[model samples]
Target chain A: MPGKVVRVRRHSNFGWKERLYLPMIFVGLGVTARHFFENFWGYMIGKVKTFVVQYPEERLDYADAFRGHPVLVALESGAPKCVACGLCEFACPTDCITILPDETRSAIERIPKVFDIDMSRCMFCGLCEEACPEEAIVMSRDVELATYDREAMLFHKEDLLRTEEQLGRRIGFIREEYNRA
Target chain B: MSDLLQAIEEKLGDAVEDSHAYRGDDTILVSHDRVLEVMQTLKDDSSFRFNMLIDLTAVDYLGRDPRFEVVYHLGSVEVEARGSEPSSLRHRLRVKSGVAEVPCEIDSVTSIWPAANWMEREVFDFYGIRFKGHDDMRRILLYEEFQGHPLRKDYPKERRQPLIGPRN
Candidate 1:
């Protein structure tokens, strides 16, 4: 079957008002008015606004469950809470944790000679902290861990181990609990 | 096991350096350059129709000559009977390549397996291994201004402490 071709007639000229450019001007004005009204209404209702937290002055409060950097706890007698059992290191899937053993006077067998937590490789799974039987290693709330050098991100025993005096002034309820603990 | 390895050997020939079938699972080690060709053959060939890429990652053998080995786990989903367990047979292929400051970009498999997008991005993000034709090749987790690749072996963990305060 062959397809049929149809011919169409073309209009010669625009109407009086269309030729005068009034309709075109009205369409342009309508578009401009619509945008202006929308923006004006948004501004009046404070919808089209930018609100940002002053990060330096207004710090965010993290929830109690927020697992941040892992911390090594210190005993009441100023000794590290780690028994140097190497359980945390073994439990770490990424092998980011490294611990060295040292003899301590207390009955608590071995102390970590050198505890290193590679924050770079650490997946922040909280597995190491959970594997700690001595309640020594814990994920702290101090999450501001921006660093320039790769070397600086690998935290050693001294860097991760937190002391009561070092925690400074308490700001939230968790700080009070940490102090009490 | 020998039959499958022999089939791969026949198809890929010299490209695959070594082939090992462990407990009905095949693992073929090949050179970095030949990975794309091998993958394409596996996908197109009738015997081994590995249409899906399960995982793609890189392992940094820091001391080895070709320091990086990109591992690809390929599989095809096979439907089972209603009462039976659905199974998938996966083949792991490791391609050895040089890892230096000059980035090593592998031919991306996202065209074959769309799921490789995030996995490749993750590998690139953590290991700094580049995928040549990735649509958006940017850091997934880390901030844009982040400095060094943290997963590299030499990255230190101590110097991040503030000078005046006690280290946390």
Candidate 2:
């Protein structure tokens, strides 16, 4: 029986009860009735909660782990925390991030002249955020970004920079997570 | 695994330039001339039925005498199901040959495996190592109009390849 071929049954020959389908229907209905009664009783008693929240009018808080568009962190001095190390630029798989740095800038020897990130090309893999050693960039919680024009999606340095006051929760989460790792 | 390697080494004496285990995985370095013969033997011969060609890729050693290293990963689909102790699954072979920058050449093992067709094409697309007997040796990964082989060690990073589609 080295190369023995054993054929197994694929289908079960249905009985009369299965063929009539009344019991099956009633069983399905029973499940529905159970849920309906539970919810109905819960609603009447105000014990169990309903998950269906009134959205748009009543917004639920987003978790700190929620990934969204990447933003550059800036201190109170209004200067970008990124030293133009080009780690994020290299780490970006889509090549959406472009950092133009001026070597002549003395006070901050490595300051980004133009940091453009094309959101259209970004797959949001979080490589750019992860590669930032300075903790300059991290994914924000604002996931509701939409625009009709293609040009609007291209985030420049001016649009990317967010102060501590602006990025309260995301920066805190990133700091905690980084410290843990 | 060593017994298997010893058998192969004994069978292919001079053809096998070197053979050793790397990171618990067996590796055989064969001369470029006998690569096809060695591959055929491995597949048809019961002792080493490496029927599956898992991967075929090329490495660029730019400054070395042999500019390219063609690596072959071979195993069998049925080996696992057979409980045959798949030391061959992790085992691989590296064939080295001096491929000149302009007209790099290597005989395609597509006839032996047929899975090597696309893999070889991808290697050709990236490393520009021309396969001798391949039916369709066109670029598999990059566009046909792509200027130079991108995976080459000397390929200029700054050189902008001509964009394919809409600029806007």
For all candidates, the clash counts are 6, 0
DockQ scores for all the models shown?
A: 0.04, 0.10
Q: Write the per-residue lDDT of candidate 2 for residues B1-168, one digit (tens) a residue.
A: 577688888887888887777665667887666788888888888777778888888889998867888888787555444343323353444434445555688888999999999999999999989888999989988888898899898998787987788545
User: Clashing residue pairs, candidate 2?
Assistant: none
lDDT of 1 at B144: 56
* Candidate 1 residue-wise lDDT, A1-181, digit = tens: 4344344577668788779898889999999898888878877998963345579897768765677777888877777888989889989989998988999677887899999988888878888866777767877777778899999988988788677554332223334554542
Best by lDDT: 2
List TM-score (chain A only) for every prediction. 0.61, 0.78
List where candidate 1 sits over 4 angstroms from the true fold.
A1-181, B21-25, B79-103, B157-168
Looking at model 1, the pairs that clash are: A151-B156, A153-B157, A154-B156, A154-B157, A154-B158, A155-B157
State the lDDT of candidate 2 residue by residue for A82-163, as single tens digits.
8888999999999999998766455766778888899988878888888888888888766666999999999999998988
lDDT of 1 by residue, B7-110 (tens): 88898889988778777667788776667788888888878878778778787777776667778877755544333333545444433334444556677778
